[model samples]
Target: MASEGSTPQQLSDDFTDLQKKLQVVIEARQRLDAQLSENQAVQKEFAELDDDANIYKLIGPTLIKQDKDEAVMNVDKRLDFIDKEIKRIEAQIAEYSENSEKKKAEIMRLQMEQQQQQQQQQQGPA
Candidate 1:
């Protein structure tokens, strides 16, 4: 047979664990957002450099123009990789948020059940 108060303790533990998981997910999302912002700044700078390099190609000497063209190509490749990484992180954040919300609802339901059980027990024979 089940004990009288064990259910409440179990529900409390489950709620705590759910809260901790949500906190971790929120921190991870913040870190990803910060990384995305930094990558965007770098991408913008790379774009500006690419534009300047293209302009130099039209008027500068042959060797200088070739070097600038190569640099722009490398920056373009790096920007493409960053874009892919940002998309992956965004997808992960969406998944984590969804899971966290579900867990929160479960915890709430468990707590309510525990409360109802306690009330029913209190109303029974002493």
Candidate 2:
């Protein structure tokens, strides 16, 4: 129920806005997933390195020599950060999905109500 007089057009617009918000959340989740994958790969590579192996980090357009221990610590931190971000974004996606479904059902109900009212009006008084 949209209070006194909401009209069908207003309900339609609300549905559109809800769908757009859901789409934005879905896109953000996709980007975060890709970033999480990349960071996991980097973490795996660092974990597989030998203690005596020379390591270089790409800073700007140059490869800077980095200590093996420091590189390992840095990658571990990055993995943790990416994991947290992915979880947060996934939570947002779930919320948006639930909201979208509820909004869709509301829109359908509103449409059906509008059709019934119009039919009654066309039939005039009984």
Considering every candidate listed, which one attains the maximal lDDT?
2
Give the per-residue Cα lDDT of candidate 1 at 34.
73
Give each model a TM-score: 0.55, 0.83
Candidate 1 residue lDDT tens string, 1-126: 122444645645655665676577667667756766765675576566744454333345453344555655755676577567667756765765665566556657667887999999999976
The residue pairs in collision within model 2 are: none
Scored against the true structure, residue 85 in model 2 reaches a CA lDDT of: 77
Residue by residue across 42-68, what tens digits does model 2's lDDT show?
778878988888999999999999999
Candidate 2 TM-score to native = 0.83
Error of 1 at 103 (Å): 0.6
Q: What would you estimate as the lDDT of candidate 1?
A: 0.61
